[model samples]
Target: MECWVPLFEIFLNSPCPETQASLWLQQSFNQPGPTTISTSSFLSLLTKPTHITITDSSSPSHTKRVMWIQTLPNAVQARVLSFLHYDCRRFCESELCQLAETMLKEGEKLDFWVKRAAHQLLDVVSRSNYEWFSSLNLDSEEEQVENEFRSLPDWLKDDVDETDLMLPWLPISQKQFNLAMQFSSCGENDDPMIEFEEGKREIVEQVIEEVDEVIKEVDEFLNPQVEELVERLKDRLLSLQSTSKAVELAGEIRELCKGGSQSLAILGKIEPWRADDEITSVLVSNLLDGNEDELGWRSHILCSVILPKLLVLKEPASRVLLTATIEYCKIHQRAAEYALLLPLILRTEGINSPICNVLTRIVTESLHQGHVSAFCQKLLSNEDDLKKFICLPCHQSLIGSKLVWTDSLFNLMQNILNHNIHLTQDSIDRLVQHAWESADRFSKSLKFGNFLLCFVTKCAPMLKSQKSLLTEATQHTNTLVTKSVLSKLSTL
Candidate 1:
């Protein structure tokens, strides 16, 4: 290191690159039996790199040195070139692209360094070069390598998968990684939605302003059509300007329609401003108007607004809506929609009401609709909704007690258990007690009561170890993690 300090200083301080490089070479290498060459000839020779002889002035005997650029080995030179700035690196590539294969081993490591250096010039490096680099069978023969290399774009192509630059949430398995790659490149909609909303708001404002301008232009004094129209049937229209009269009229109308949905819908259509409850009542009435054939013609606005409101309302009268909806569904075979809405209604109603009749109807419906599991689970979800519902006073003998028992209550209880919604051990005795009392009070047959008692006891608490959805999901996650670990271990 000490021997090179003075020589390094000469290289740094020297005005001419040729002299500095020449002196650098002299000190770096020394060999015997050297011949002299002129300064111009030596400089020309340096352009085409080759072994050369130079006299070492620092040696007292004028010892000779054979100097070349071999101080930098092939691997280290490639590494150094990799760190250069984009513009400088590009210039180096133009000059040295031919020498690249000769200097570095022909493999991915050398190819990767070249690609990496070029990548620094592009902001979206990860997006570029993925397909070309990945598709190449570098281990293949020269002909295949050449063919593959030729297939790659002259310029870098945009990446097909963005998983590489993102966090390594991609699993150990390649198939899973490919499947789970979050396809965010094209379907991004947040900005587009915001822009669309702004545009729509602007259009709406412009339309309102244009309408106001048109209204301003209409001279009320001269526009006889407006006056004549207003005069023709002013008696039929309800004027809301007179607050006291309008309110009294509304109250009277509300009283008249207080009976049911059909009346409420008529009341809503008569006056529609600031009337949410009346409007919803009209909507539900319309939705369940036994128009399964006319679903295509039904107003989406009415259906969309009323269904949720009806479901959220916990009134026993909601049963009317439920019963109507069920009849409509059965007639239309709308099992999909009925199945989804029924559960929502049941969850809202809870177990307090006399809902056993509703459950029995649904049970009958489920025979054809095929969503028995979902409906049963929902019924039992409300702190024993099914249990308490089955024991309601009004519902005890009111169900007509007339089923043929084709699908017996025992099998129904088993189905409920299969759905993983059973009661606790403590509730079993009480439920049995309630069933027997109801059976006796209603003067039902002993045989039927005995079957009911047997069904309830078996369904509650005995099968507590049955796998619920939560337990199944937990087990599934554990299995996935174990498989992933095993995959990684095998790879290692």
Candidate 2:
């Protein structure tokens, strides 16, 4: 079946190729054989450059070839279009116009593949020359074609307008068409007057005023209803005693309070002073004391809703909740679950707060490499937090831990140096020593080498002052790291 693809290509390029050959190929594709042509093989065939040279004489043959492709099964045609980088200039003006119409028709389908192909077709049309529109012959007399043009998306019409072409046949109102023509005429003249036709500007202002009124009416109708719903949910939360049932209800409230303004409004209505002390304790315990084997969803829900509501309470109450949560995480080895709340903690309490000291201690003591990696990623992603984290006293334990050679640790180190964050001498010494010890692990050699290159480049002055350590790194087991170190040494 794969052998037939090359023969089909030869037939397409053949001078005066008979239509009968295409019909024969279609029949061969349909016939049962020992090996069936797979989608991948068909994709390879479509991607090959068509060697057919275009000329006035060969235009009809080109159209025939395109039409032959259209005769393929809709599934095959859709797949080819989705993956193929179609060059629109290969098709003649008439065929290109027809292809656009076909793409518009296919765009209406609900199939994933068909929709993808239609999107690809629209991209191709957007990148091509505007001469194809001239071939459309979209005049008032051709009402069917005019209506089809009108049905095209407004974005595509805007794209055409950007070309500044005098396309009077475009499907717009007579007044708009006349206005556009006047603008074009004024642009071409040396000293031309630019003015809207009488009453047109007033009509535009009236439409704008009507639209604004509709928007205000819609907002007035929705805000009070949303506020009322939030108020009821808050009241129900205060009355609930079962932790599981309360969490279930909180999920619905979370959905309504997604945006910042909405969330603050919802939080403002919830009188945390009225929330029962026993209920808050039960929710926090359920969040922090879940089984290690349980999925992370329950913790995520509680941290997102219950934790934020608790933090909204006045000073002593909020500080007590923060202290209790951090202490529970340390004693129960719940660092992985607790990491989920870091973003909220950072936003509310900030990086300099005592909770950050607990975070550093957890990283030093955590058993799983995966959890530490996630925690580091969350910290490194925030520039201000990362700056403070690098300077923490226990940061050396993070750099010199047994899991020091992992990708996340290397990224954390690289980001610290990349930002020119001031790391104490002890931290830098520990990082270099750990790199040397881990360089012989063949699996991580490439990653180790990349980190060393970044380290040497960013900390060149510090490395030069410690010549013995720098010299030892050049003779390391990993050749990539050795080369990088030697390159830096020569420049010194």
Candidate 3:
């Protein structure tokens, strides 16, 4: 079966006229012996000595290879394809080189061929003096291995059944090995490995640098063909095709092209979409409207670029663009960017977005942080439209959380009142609720210290007109503050 399959493949791969090859293949299939389909038959099938043309002009040779490949038995077709790929790649200028690439690409999809060809190619790359990896034009040895593995047929990818496509070379931890060895006498006592000084920080930096170098190399390799590929990938992400898969594939291709300096040079020319721009704005908007998992990944991607830009874009247009992004983050419940966006949002007006509510909640909840109270106090010092919007809601929200109100709220309230901006209705409602609650619970029962007394003392001027409400609040104020309050009022 194997021998006959290869014979049939030779018929398909040959450039003999289709009519003649088909007629010959019919005869060859009817015969039982492998020798019936001879080399002479293959030689006779070629219409052109070196040039194989097909009816389609756009893909004359590719069309021919596809039509021919269909006639071979699956396994034999794969073997023929392996040899063809080896040859065409070996001699890039051969007339069959284009045909060979198409054949192997298609062959990679067939089940029987994928594993076999992958193993064969992996072995060749691992053991042989393959010039592809040997070229100094390739930047890093690790990168060369990565690309060679990637350029393998898709079925031969690292995670596929053909994972032996690259040797499993991940560094194993010594502690894990020692733990295993402690349990059994027969355990393989591999040498206890030492830490390589390669922590995540160093690895991440190296990967980033490698990626940058690869991008630069891709830019120089860019031709019309490669540009079309980049455009296709970009379009796939833009056109609502699966972005995670596409981005993943794009990342691989980006690394793959790094094999040659020319390829890497071409890649660097390919720009990722800029932050807060129309392209990314549309992307973020669509992504936020997707499912939660999709939104999460998209948020991460956007954060990489947008978070950085939020800190640097001084242009009004960019600021407006950032406002939209903050709103998106808020709607998505992403807390990662709040620290960066909070300061920027604190300065923008005409932007009463729903995100502000989320940000308000974050600020209110973050009082437990050592510096949050201090930071909020500082932000409240300079009164502006931006500060007013942030402060009013934040102060109102903070009153509801015991953690923040304990100390942070008092300090923040004093700061806001000192700015002379009348607290909004929301602020008044929360303050009234808090004061009423405090009076009912604490004002009379406990002795208040001077610090607590100082708060009421400073606020006497503002509360003088609302004595009726204050009298009710004083009833429940902490007992310590209650006496201090009474004493302070007597002095007033």
Candidate 4:
């Protein structure tokens, strides 16, 4: 252990890197060496990594240790590089990319050491940074800022689909048309005279026109299949009770359209059933009616089927669906904010409608327990209706129902109290009240007490044996819990 201390001291005290590295390398191979070099000095040796040499036949553990040391943070990487150089052949391509992406996401400053290491990697790839740079067009200062922060530019906000990048259906510009023609044409029948060449050009133009006609014909021939696919998409949309799928389907159709697909032609083929009404029905059914089966169907209809259908309408009652949704929730006493609206911001119809006013009134009036339970049962049964007629109300209703479930509230509180030390006063109060109420209600009926205890002692443990906080909390608060349990019991 004492063999290398004098050698390490001499290496550290040495001014020249070559001398220090020579001594360090000689001692690294020697067994029983205890060097008292500081972390900074050790790091300096690592950063100049060329000094250390291990054979390819070294044990896996030694290789891994060397690699791990090299991949450490800025100070560590620098020290390791001094000894090992910035070579990273041991890491997988995907793993390196992931690490880079993570570092970029974390807003870590690109220190000199990190940049040098990254540059060495760039050299290994031997590809021009410009080509990779072109793929991410963050040339502008604003774009550069957004990119550095791992965010997309405003221009890319709507470019949500991977397929959109591959599609070639966008209307062709005059320049693109010329370019396409230029690339398509190749001939050896050359005219010597300039005037004769004009004739050849005319002939080529005619041939290009013919090719364009053929392309158009091919597109026309494929229209039927595209139309069939669009119809299938429409059918799927209309059958869904949730609008979530509508946004996704919209993206899919957008890609199809961009791909020069003839799916848009099927919009004309839809039967004259009112789209707004159909969409309204879907929203109501999912949000109020609790029809999970029709959820996927409704999503397709709202954004994909309904919006496009509305665009085609001679007199589009676009607001009808939104109004109907709000009004239905009002009459049904459901909450007003729809969760689907979060994603479907572009498709939502109305900010102010009679249905919304009614929903507000219903939520305000039915905030109490007796009214809430009655309202919840009705809303749960007719979730689809609520979603169709009033999406916001459906969300509000669900949120309200979740809050109203005192047993769930108690458990949630107990969990926070036992597991989370950073509990806010409001959360603590809310949970305490919920637990107290649940305990009060349980203590009144012998059957309820047995059921509660049995569930905590048996079913829950079987399901998740590791956590017993809920059982413990309920037991600790048994007396106060029993008192509240009795009070609620008298009413039940």
Candidate 5:
């Protein structure tokens, strides 16, 4: 068997047609000495061929490999497949689908290894590529195909219980398992293997119990190490003097946090360092002073973990941190970075003078329209916030900005108008003038025309004195705007 591997590669890599080589390999698998080879060596032979195109199961080479696997003795066949299921290199979806079909056709002759291998392959293939399983057309009414199409879980019902084989392959966390269950069905009534006879209710309970036991074991094992690492992080946070050093330390802190709730619990117990004014200042300064590209990882830790925790400190400490953050946004013009701090700023500082300055700068100076749109959507959710945003000192600049004329912003403006929020007369005039300019500039645009129409209809009573503007709009060159204005002139 070991000697045959080199010869197999030589034959496969030769100039001969792949069909002839595949036929020779199939005959080689049937030879008495090679049939007695260990299961590991057999798996190596299957995977070792770099020339084997495993993706196309219908290809002659791939079909011949499938036939070779079937010709192996029952014990060797089952073991090879079972090992293949867990190997580092995975079979493609097409190959797995073919294997599943073969196992299902075995019927009464399906023994323990074959049944278990079939179940494993089906479970993996179904979860990873559900469309293939869904396309099996298992609902066919023909007697023979229907018999072979029986669900794998139903076939394995007598052989294995939930604890023996089912739990081992299930998602470890209850949340992941629940999400999988939600989308795992083939149809309304068709049972996939992920669904047990006990149904989701009981299966979920069992999963929770199993997950708790595993978590408890992990917590017991990791508690001491997490506590030690938390203390180490505290020392590094205090002693680090340079921005580059702090950035390096940030990577270690992020890794510690990835240990999940164990490290968090340990860090939570040691809250004195998180609240220290000196430490908070150092973190904020490093975050602001570090090079933008070098500080990417540290920014996430500071914003998500350090900044939020520091903001809960006393007035003097939190106020100083907020001022520094505002100045950083003003100088760097990093709109995306500033967004990470918005929720904290809104909660702790409200829409104050400093906040308004940064928001105005973002709207006018930032090139990323997506970040600008996100800031607007989040900050202007309610009527009062919307009114406050519209009344900014740079409100005119915002109106003429590129984002204000977009469809999404138009919808936002329409929402404000529908609520009947009162804007100062000057603000209303500037908004209407900007809309008219936009409509005239892009005269053929249906979207801008519709925006102008919405403003005219919704703000009709407020704009009664602006007859010249309405009359000008009536004779607009765009045919859509003219027809729409004519249709609604009586109401106006």
Candidate 6:
């Protein structure tokens, strides 16, 4: 009963190949052919599950040996015999024989006779009849249906006993029942009071049980005498056992202790197989393969716990964990915590992943809502992989933030302008334009007017030839920069 029988019950109850072959053999017995077995012979011989090899004397006919030669349950065997279109049902009837074979005089049947018959008949059959079920050449019509049924969880196949579940006869008197039926039958009107009373009583009973449990737990924890008695009993029990047995029993005690709600306090500790890579892979697989009912909770666990653990680890292991987080977000459509990890993941792993698009969307939305952390801002300023993925709002948030305008801003801007590598001139221009627009649109903004101009001004000698840089700078300049914003554009 404790072995998870429900999981295998459906499969066990399914039509065995032997059963199908039994049906086929019964049909063959009724056919007009030399290969068919006579009813008298089949009944007498089939009584023992010894294999029977039937061969066609006709030219080029293949012989089949039905080898299931063991006793099938009476019901199943009877059903198999009924497959014959003829009067095969007569074989299933008992008390038909005038002389019943009684074994009262003997201790048991002769083992010699049984063994001789079994070796010859079964050895001749060579294999089970069930193996030839495919020889009947069935269609693929039931293939998909069988596969889906096979994949179903065992609990779905288990039939709960409704005998225990059925409500007892109503406790009300016959007069009360008649009155209730009369009211219930009149225009078939529903009585809300009747339904409400039943539901209200169940809820009140449940609440009282929960309250009693809470009070008991409180009393147990607060009572010092109970704790002392438990400690004394534990010491006495250990004292009674030998040292080796005591140590052995200690493992069971530890395991029992690790199974309650209180055990979750150690989720951060090792021994949950934290050191094993195989364990992580298995945990991830189980999460992904969990039934639809568990998926929401699994996703919550992934985001709240798994993600923090992954972030602390080194990748490509972390990369695999990151993929799990994004794939979960991409499929489950609930990415609140995962979206928060996008920036840290982007900074650490970069954009070489299948879930980059999911990550991009997460980052854009997070940045737009100003949900990104300060560390993410520094990462965004440095990492170019996610730079192109950033939306206009994200770019605006980055530029207008106080973090971006620190002393490093001058060198960062200078390197960005001089590099002229991954980002195009037009893209850089648009970024500056959007930054100015975001600052102006928001009530409070950074004074990028001079800071940004300083970068261009610091590189004025180098940009004197590239007037496009001066023109772009001039376009982004505002009142915060009093000096000719772009010194190279002084004449222009």
Return the top candidate by TM-score: 5
Kindly indicate the candidate among 3 and 5 with the higher lDDT. Answer: 5
lDDT digits (tens) for residues 18-69 of candidate 4: 2245445545656465655533343333333332344565554232233333
**After superposing candidate 2, which stretches have Cα over 4 Å from the reference?**
1-4, 7-67, 83-97, 106-111, 126-232, 235-492
Q: Assess candidate 1 and give its TM-score to the true structure.
A: 0.21
TM-scores vs. true structure, each candidate: 0.21, 0.24, 0.21, 0.22, 0.26, 0.22
Error of 4 at 47 (Å): 23
lDDT (tens digit, per residue) of candidate 3 on 197-236: 2243243343335333422332343668777876765555
C-alpha lDDT values of all predictions: 0.34, 0.44, 0.39, 0.36, 0.45, 0.35
The per-candidate count of clashes, in order, stands at: 0, 0, 39, 71, 0, 2
* lDDT by residue (tens digit), candidate 6, 1-492: 222132123223533322234444556567774752444444444443344444666755554433232244434333333222122233433311210111111224424333332322222233323444456556564565444533424553332121111111111222333344444432346676775555444543443353233223222232364345445434543343244443343343334333232221222221222323333333444433323211123323343334444434433444455454444443333223322343224333322222333344443322211123322332344334222211111112222212222322323333333221123333344444444444333212233454455434433334445556445544544554535455435733
Query: In model 4, which regions exceed 4 Å deviation?
Result: 1-59, 63-234, 238-248, 252-390, 393-402, 414-421, 443-492
Q: Which structure is stronger by TM-score: 4 or 5? A: 5
Q: Global lDDT for candidate 5?
A: 0.45
Which is the leading candidate under lDDT?
A: 5
How close to the true structure is residue 16 of candidate 1, measured as C-alpha lDDT?
28
User: Which candidate, 1 or 6, has the higher TM-score?
Assistant: 6
Worst 10 residues of 4 by lDDT: 163-172
Clashing pairs in 6: 49-69, 67-129
CA deviation > 4 Å runs, candidate 5:
1-222, 242-248, 258-306, 309-341, 355-367, 382-492
Which segments of candidate 1 are over 4 A away from where they belong? Answer: 1-323, 331-349, 366-369, 374-492
- Tens digits of per-residue lDDT, candidate 5, 17-52, equal 222333344466677753644334544445443332
